[model samples]
Target: MQTANNCNFRSSALGPAPLPYHPHHPGLPLALPAPVAAAPALPVPVPVAPVAPLAALPTPPPPPPPPATIVQTLTRHVPVPVLVPKPFPVPVEKLVHVDRPVPVEVPVPRPYPVAYPVEKFIKVDRPYPVHVAVPVPRPYPVPVAIRAHYEPLHHHHHRHHYLHHHHDW
Candidate 1:
């Protein structure tokens, strides 16, 4: 049967047999592997010598004094105001209306049988020039010789020479 001391092994079949708790019986001593012999002791190292302290550095010279500044006072004048003369005022009046009789208009007598000039339009036959259709002469096709040379003009001198030679053609 399994017990607390025998819990080290997961399988009870391979574990050690469990011992009963006894107040008088002393517990069985744990069976451990034999103690291993320690390796040989290493040699002691020598102590290092202490270093000397460094010397203090010399103090630096003081900086130059700053330049002096100038102070000045400024003054300004104020302008005076001038007075102008005022113009004279004009008087205004209201108009009054008076009742008056209007004159009667007289009709003038007209002369009998008034003569008026009448306008007359006459149709006249005039001969005009007539347009006639005429056939235009077609230009005859002429065969011309054309020669083209494909060349790369890399230099400015060569391009100018080629243009001058082809200008006449």
Candidate 2:
């Protein structure tokens, strides 16, 4: 009895235990793996020639009828006044020649006055002699054989300049 109680307690802890395996099931159908289907085939294209537009038909000619004729009568009437050329009066002055030639007095025009003779006197201007004191070109003192050499003059000039400058504070 203790063993049966222990089994029952273990079965209750596992929650009613799993159902026993059966040969036939009545609750649900067995699950099947999903079926893979192939893609559908594409339609084949048909080749066709382009159709041309039809040309327009020519127009029918018009029917002909009868020709027409006209008659006219001509009449003439004379004008009362006919245009005649009339004579012109002759000029007595233009036809006859005169004994004394027609006096044409043409007045003689006076000549233009002669220009006055101009007496031009040239006034002589006495030019005051500008006494420009042109500095007489003094020819450089020609060095002679008897003259002293430049060395002495250069020494003398240096000594003079030194003596003059020495006195300045």
Candidate 3:
């Protein structure tokens, strides 16, 4: 804590060098702070009455808005179709057939199939019913050859319905 002015300035050309105990000098071991005297008590200001808080008028209905704005409200979810006029327009003598669309559901016949495939045309050999003429051998074969000319040959031969030549075997 001793000041440079208190030391003998004979050898050092440098101006007033800080002592190691000086608080602002660098590279010196830190020393505990000197104990300070207790602070004096300060006087607190008195709380004002808050100037009576101005009276707060009723807010004047927001000053009637800068300009008028239209506010529309939606009421109906769906508009129903009206069929006949409110209370029968015609007299009792006149007959009227009328009904509201909302109350009644008119039945309409759906379309019948004009042209539709009953089954798929696959690449299959579909079966078909047909009468088949099969070649069946007779129980006992009997030659049904009718002879045109029943001429008795040199000996005898089978009765055929065709002309026979002598060279025919």
Candidate 1: 10-residue stretch with minimal lDDT: 121-130
Candidate 1 local lDDT, 85-129, one digit each (tens): 222011111111112111111111121011111111111111111
**Candidate 3: tens digits of C-alpha lDDT, residues 79-125:** 22223323432333322122211121111111212122223111111
TM-score head-to-head 2 vs 3, winner: 3
For all candidates in order, the CA lDDT equals 0.25, 0.24, 0.28
What TM-score, over all chains together, does every model reach? Answer: 0.11, 0.11, 0.17
By TM-score, the candidates rank as 3, 1, 2
Candidate 3 residue 33 C-alpha distance from true site, Å: 1.1
Task: Tell me how far the alpha carbon of residue 31 in candidate 2 is from the true structure, in angstroms, after superposition.
Answer: 21
What RMSD value applies to candidate 1? 46.8
Where does candidate 2 stray beyond 4 Å? 1-37, 54-169
Off by over 4 Å in 1: 1-28, 31-34, 50-169
**RMSD score of candidate 3 (Å):** 40.6
